[model samples]
Target: MWRAIFRKKLFIAIMTAQFMIFAFDTTTRADDVSIGFLYTIPTLMGFLIIERGLQITIVVLSITLILTGCFFPVPIETDLLVFFANRVLSIITVLITGIMVNYRVRMEQTLGDALAKERKASAMQRAFVSMVSHEFRTPLTIIDGEAYRMGKVKQAVSPEDLQTRVKSIRQAVSRMIVLIERILYTSRAFDNKISMHLERVNLWTLLKSIGRQHSEVALSHQIKVNVHDLPVSIRADRNLVTYILDNLIGNAIKYSPEGSVVEVTGQTNGTMAVIAVRDQGIGIPEADLPNLFEPYYRGGNVAGISGSGVGLYLVETFVRMHGGRILVESVEGQGSVFTVQMPVAGAEPAPAVSTGESSFPDKQ
Candidate 1:
């Protein structure tokens, strides 16, 4: 044990200095160099205890200090108070530094946790989109094959029967393709995966079809869908615009209770397309409106509602990408309204419309 202490740098220096201290007038404890010899070994011991460098270090230092400093006396003044004071100071320093280091380590761990969550969310989005590709590719391949086979059969089959079967097959395949694309787009948008590609599209024609498609739903709901402008085209991605409309119109239908009003109105005011989807259903609470676009965030009245909470988020992202904005208005039990403003190609807010809205559709 004594040998191990002698081998340590602190202990060796202590021994060397002890020899030097005695070489001079050995009675002075306050001589800085002498006090250094007086203080060194105990400080090392304090560090050992606090750093858990003991059981290993103290076993040796314990025996050595007792022997050299107390057991075998050097005919000099050894003040007990000074020795203890130095040890206490060293221990305090070790404890405080240790605590701070631990705190920093904990903070780093927390940061890592947040980063991990974000990464997991991103991976889930990618996986969801990837599945869309795989699933759609298979159905699309079958559709292509069926269409090709039926085309060949056209040469042999009667034309009347052929037309009906072909039309059904084509329509069904088209719907599937559109659904798949919507899923991909919507997922990416909600996942915060945004990089838009902007292009020019006739605003009037786009809203006209969107209005016409939902015409039956509007009539049933007793809602009127109006296209404010007839032939004005806007600079934006047509696919993304379609997705935004789908969510709005679809949501209107979902919550409309079979005979409510839904209005689809649009206009190119100055340099943007102003589109609004208004419906009469169970209105959203004023408090819940803030989090409407948050993923999985549903309102109080929507407790049993069949929605994934990705709609408004996708809408917001798409609108922003087009360097545009969205606004909502609602009163409890009256209904809700959502308006989207998208920038023109060369107008203010040069941002483009990011595609991939069909990312998270109503999961069936």
Candidate 2:
């Protein structure tokens, strides 16, 4: 704010200096057309700093007319038409300068806004890299340790035990793959390369597949799915839908304690499909809920949790791409429910870009 005020004051000072120069020359050298042109300096400067550029131009034009008339009076013996024509030419020049000044100012503003967005995107990219490194390390370490154990205990370990170890390693790899795919998809989305190819998807089968995929993680917890009554099929982008479910369920498992229930439910309401992932986990803080979907934003309760804070952000993005909305309802200790509402096939038109805030239930 202070910087804006300083710029305004500086602009006024520059304009004042230019007007003084014009006034001095008018008295000493009134016949000089260039002396009258000095007023354009202040008029253009006003457009650069002030939003009221048009008003400033009019003020400068009026002042110049008055000062010029005082000094360059039309002699009663001189031809009146010649004097009027000269004055009219000077006024036209001032008007053209004002228009050009305003145009330049608008162009500068457009460039400034684009530069700001570029900077923000750069920051997000840096955060994503750091997060990927941190998240990948844990899974890679688990896989490496298991491989080392298998190498050392070869033949000595029973076939059953060997199978279990291999399975564990595979599960770790699976987790890593999910994370990597999300990163790739998100990158594509950023590049505007993500496209929705809607096809008929069986919700029941999809839910069961997601459950089975995470069976390793579910060994210590329960993923209760209740989608039997849901529409047998819905038109949606299968890959994007999978991404959304993966994040939601994966998060529910990650944040919840061992043996906690992570419930998945689906239903149909009119032309919309409703799906929710409710978890008995460490619930989001009411204060932090509003920024939950913001890129790289983690809640206060997520300390020590292994998360990049990008999962929910990607979930929101994919949901919006389907012309749907995601809503969050949480309590500090009672857990949170993420409810998604998307239109059924051909129910609503999806746009290339969407604008809206994700819904957050009021804190109770």
**How many residue pairs clash in each candidate at the backbone level?**
11, 0
**Model 1, span 146-178: residue lDDT tens:** 678776763577777778767766765765755
- Candidate lDDT scores, in order, read 0.61, 0.74
- Candidate 2: what lDDT? 0.74
lDDT of 2 at 263: 93
The parts of candidate 1 lying over 4 Å away from their true place are 1-109, 112-182, 190-197, 229-231, 267-270, 303-305, 346-364
The TM-scores of all predictions, comma-separated, are: 0.50, 0.64
Runs in model 2 lying further than 4 Å from the true structure? 1-101, 153-155, 208-216, 220-222, 285-291, 294-297, 346-364
lDDT at position 312, candidate 2:
88
Model 1 TM-score on a 0 to 1 scale: 0.50
